[model samples]
Target: MKLESYVKLTFLSLSLFLLIACTSEEASKNKTEEPTKQSQTEKKKENQTSLKENIPNAPTNTDELIQYPGGKNAGKSIGILPEDEKKQVHKDLDEFPKITEDASETEKELYWNNLLYLFQEDYIDPQTVLEKWKMESFGSPDIEDPRFQFKENLNVEILLDASGSMNGKIGGKTKMELAKDSITEFSSSLPEGANVALRVYGHKGSGSDQDKQLSCESSEVVYAMENYEENNFEEALNKFNPSGWTPITLALNEAKEDMAEYNGDQNTNIIFLVSDGINTCGGDPVAVAKSLADSNIKPIVTVIGFDVDAKGQEQLRNVADASAGIYANVNDQKGLSEQFKSAQDIAEKWDRWKRDSLSDLDAIKVDRNFMILAFSNDWGRKRDKQNSNLISASDYLYYEKKMITKEMYNYLSDKRDEQKYLTDRSQEEVVSYLESINDKTYGEMKKSIEEKYKQK
Candidate 1:
């Protein structure tokens, strides 16, 4: 019985040893799996990091594939181009065509990306060819200047002087008849969307206010585009004739009142004053001019003087000057008609009276526009001062003279806005100036300027 017990104990020990060996092998397998999974995770992390770093740098390699913004340098710096341009560049790059499977990867990629960037909205990289195009046809980037174009339609007021002189012959017809004929032509010549008015004076008489002063006036916005008739323009002109003395100031004032209610998108209000003379009946012409100079209802004063004497000349000049307009001196009655016709043609062809204004100082280059010292109204009063356009030393030794004024100082201010023709001088100043300057004609003042500039 003792021998049998010993053999059983030996078998028990062997079974325990085999079980421990199997457990050791299982642990080893688990240890090996942990390292293998760890290696895979590390590799994945490295790949993501590399991608993140490379995002800002475009690939130089031809074989490598990448996306770029359209209308831009994919591999280079982008500039000034807007969003759509960026996408276009990218699209063209994507569309670089492939000829065959064996084609070089660089060539194929280039072909595909180029076409893609050209057409696709989302494309980022653009090819070399697409970069050359520009948007100059769209005009200036400054849209403000272009938008100020006169509206398509216009409204015109032909304010004519039907004084006794209009009865005299011109252009094989009386000045009055010739003016009517031209007015008729202008009415007929206007575009489809034009509103025209005819205001005439001297239709009354020398003895009557309607004739010599203000009452003889008549007005009609005959072919108002709002109520257009092809022949209606001609019919309106049939009712004008010669009447009384030239009351220009009264006519203009009345015109402002007449046009008060007629508002439109385009502020095209014109006063075509055709007359033989200036203010003959009543009212102050210069004061009238001063009144209209800076007003919002500013009419473009185009004066045509028909056989106008010195008085006629002075009257027409004042009217034109005050309104910021052009004056034509026609010697003959026929010339008057032709001038009117020319004016009509000009009005028809150009939306604006002139391409740019004569007052546009820009047309006269600042460098050559003025001999500053001579133009000044103040000189040799308090001190003898001289100035060159550009300031420098030792020039005062030359002892030249210069005139200066408040207007001059304002003009030379560095920050003055260049877009406008004139400053916002007060109307009171203008009115006062007009009232005070009756004894001083431009010619007389100019003639005595040199003598007055010297200190007494």
Candidate 2:
């Protein structure tokens, strides 16, 4: 009976030992798992905090900040929309080509984010940009002498059209006689030492079909370009008789040759083309004028349409415009004198501008340069901010199981494009102005002459 009791006690001790081993193993498993669970919880909280910090606060009044007014969803948020639906909306908004087909969705998203910032509806005001531009200096120093001294070797050529049209009567006197008288008087009023030449066209043939070719080719420098001589000019005036086709092109070509001896920047050459009709010859006067203007002599070619019709005016005007010259219209001798006076005034104004306007032009150039720099720098800063804001907003929406609408992205993109266009245009305008300063001033001078002398 005692042996049986000892065996039962040993079995009870083995069972206690097995129970303790199982408890220790269970405690070790719990200890290992607790840290992993706590780590996961901490990571999730950190992600939430970061997302909240990244999201920009919604504007109190978007109407003033955003540019999309009266849109169907202008002020509405699309954060609650499904991702697929948002993508479809974006597809609908797509107009111009985006990056490329191979671009990943992340890249596309980044591009959109940039657009949102750059083209925000309410952006940096243009006036603000101007202010910033005004504050900077472009480093254009003043010149000791901006005045352009006039070159004294002045040569003037009078190209008179002696076609049959000039035989017409004005105030009971033949147009030719009146023109000759006017030329004589005008020459007497010119400044001393001025070289002058007389050219005549259409003085060799009758205005008939049989003589058309000869008349068209008839042009002569009756008085070669030289110092003004009253007797020689009078002889030249009386030599031509009006009775043929108007060979305006031939006349201009001959006049150009007459000035070959003194055609250069060291001298100022001017052509006064007096015509009563269009070029009857199959010649391109406009082309001739352009060539003359582009020549080394580069003489100023002013056209005086004497009692011409609409067609003649158009032709003459085109010649003047092409040559960067001026057109004047006159009916009688009195009008002719006034037109000549206007020419004198224009010359004076041109000289004045050359002497005094260089400083003004320099200032304008400096201002334009500063403005361009300001515009470019401002554009970059604004674009970066816009992109950053868009990225944060997009991330926030993604974390919240929301999405940005295609319309929003498209609007931003359009705005960004518009700003870019504006910046480009601003730069282009300044550059163009700088390049055309001299030409523009000359144009103004010509315009003034035309307006003052053109027939009412």
The number of the candidate with the highest lDDT is: 2
Model 1 alpha-carbon miss at residue 399, Å: 60
lDDT of each: 0.43, 0.57
Q: Per-residue lDDT of 387-425 in model 2, one digit per residue for the tens?
A: 444443444433332333354445445545554555445
Deviation in Å, model 1, residue 256 alpha carbon = 1.2
lDDT of 1 by residue, 1-456 (tens): 889999999999999999999999999999999998986666444323211121222222211211222122211111323555444433433332213323343433343233222221111111100110000101112212221234444557777776666776533457677677666656666655556776766555553544433443433333333323546656655655565666676777766666665443345555677777666656776676566555655445567665565445556766766665556555444445554554354354443334432222232223111212211211111011111111111111112222222332233232122201111122223223323322442334333432422201
Question: Which stretches in model 2 have alpha-carbon errors above 4 Å?
Answer: 1-149, 343-456
Instruction: Name the runs in model 1 displaced over 4 angstroms.
Output: 1-149, 206-231, 262-265, 341-456
Clashes of 1: 52
Against the correct fold, how does model 1 do in TM-score? 0.41
Model 2: how far is 236 from its true place, Å? 1.7
**What TM-score fits each model?**
0.41, 0.46
RMSD in Å for candidate 1, one decimal?
A: 31.2
Backbone collisions counted per model: 52, 2
